[model samples]
Target: MNEEPRLSAQDMIERLEPALSPMTRIRAVAALLAGLAGAVFVGTLWWSEPGPLPGRTQLAFAVFTVFCLAWAGYGGWLLTRRAALFATDRVIAAWIGLVASLTTTGIVTAVAVRRGTGTGPALAVGGLFVAVALVLTVRAHARRAALLRRVRELTGPEE
Candidate 1:
């Protein structure tokens, strides 16, 4: 007679997902959306401007756009691969990302506000990044909580 396993593979995987990469699929999606949107929005504004832009401003735009694209590419790659990042690591990463998004948005929007061009687009792009960052932060916290809960469940209640 064959004995049934205690837990189904799918159920176990679901329970353990928060421990592995801290929900890689969700994090990947967050990164992909933020990076891809930021790159497209910024790059379009950078190129579509009719007025002559300052050399330094152009360089900054190019560098920023390239970095966003690189982030997007990394997210896409993560979807197919596995990288271990603990819950605390995910939280730290999310906060750093949020700060980066805020800073970049502030600087770029200030530039456009002062120049009186592309201000609206700058805000829109920045808003998108900020929103994604917030989502990432919340998700990271949730993942951490879930992982802690799993640990508690596995180890049983405190004495």
Candidate 2:
């Protein structure tokens, strides 16, 4: 009797390539474009400002922009990986939550240090962002847990 040899990793990937839906490709491209657009928009805003920002404000703005760009790019890139769909979605959601939380914290800290009438509105807006971030983080964790259970079922019991 003749038997077929096991497919290598590369062969398996090649076999699976055509099975990927066009929607996945579209989503990846859309994400990549959005990431690029967001980075450009932030850079343009900074460049078009009339005067130089103070050192501390400049540092804060730079940190916020860096985190935003990093997460946007990472989210786009992660979609292209061959990992489980739910897992990738969870990761992207978590990144978004992290970026939002960090940005809100930085803005709130800056406002508190400045300490003026405007601080009230700034804090209010920051608080709203924090609430949204908390929700997203919680949802992502729940989705990840569900995905973990699905993965375990597919793989069966382990020793």
Candidate 3:
């Protein structure tokens, strides 16, 4: 009986390169679009009437916007790198966590400021955000871990 030769990790990766390349590019483009959308949203907020937002609240919003832009830009940059496909699963998980945390912060800040309420509501909302972030981060980490395990199994033990 004749059998096909087993491929080395490098050979397997080479064979898969064509398929992976497009995925990386798509991720990069998505990141860029998200960043652009976030920037536009911030711009719209600036163009709108200031309403009753205090200077401190405005500053907070500006800081949050900058953080959003930075992370999205980082994601795009990371996905465009030559080693993008080789990035560790942990790195991707961390990026997801950062994005979630930033989004939660922005939403909670906006709600708190818009309502102009006492500390009670703000604290409640902040707690909820923290809980949600924790859940998302955990889920992302678990998923990445599973993917890594499957890849490892396919590729054999790491060098």
Every candidate's lDDT: 0.77, 0.67, 0.65
- Please list all clashing residue pairs in model 1, or write none if there are none: none
For model 3, give the 10-residue run with minimal summed lDDT: 82-91
Error of 1 at 114 (Å): 1.3
| Candidate 1: regions farther than 4 A off | 1-86
Q: In model 2, which regions exceed 4 Å deviation? A: 5-27, 48-52, 112-115
Residue 6's lDDT in candidate 2: 71
lDDT of 3 by residue, 78-102 (tens): 5655532544533564555556565
Q: How many residue pairs clash in model 2?
A: 0
What's the CA RMSD for each of the models? 7.4, 3.8, 5.9
The candidates, ranked best first by lDDT, are 1, 2, 3
lDDT of 2 by residue, 1-159 (tens): 899997654455456663335676566666666767777777777778788887876776676677657656765675656633554565565667667676767677676867754666666777777877777777878888887787577655754
- Compared with the true structure, the alpha-carbon lDDT of candidate 3 equals 0.65
What is candidate 2's local distance difference test score?
0.67
Q: Rank the candidates by TM-score, best first.
A: 2, 3, 1
Better of 1 and 2 by TM-score: 2
Per-candidate TM-score against the hidden true structure: 0.48, 0.70, 0.56
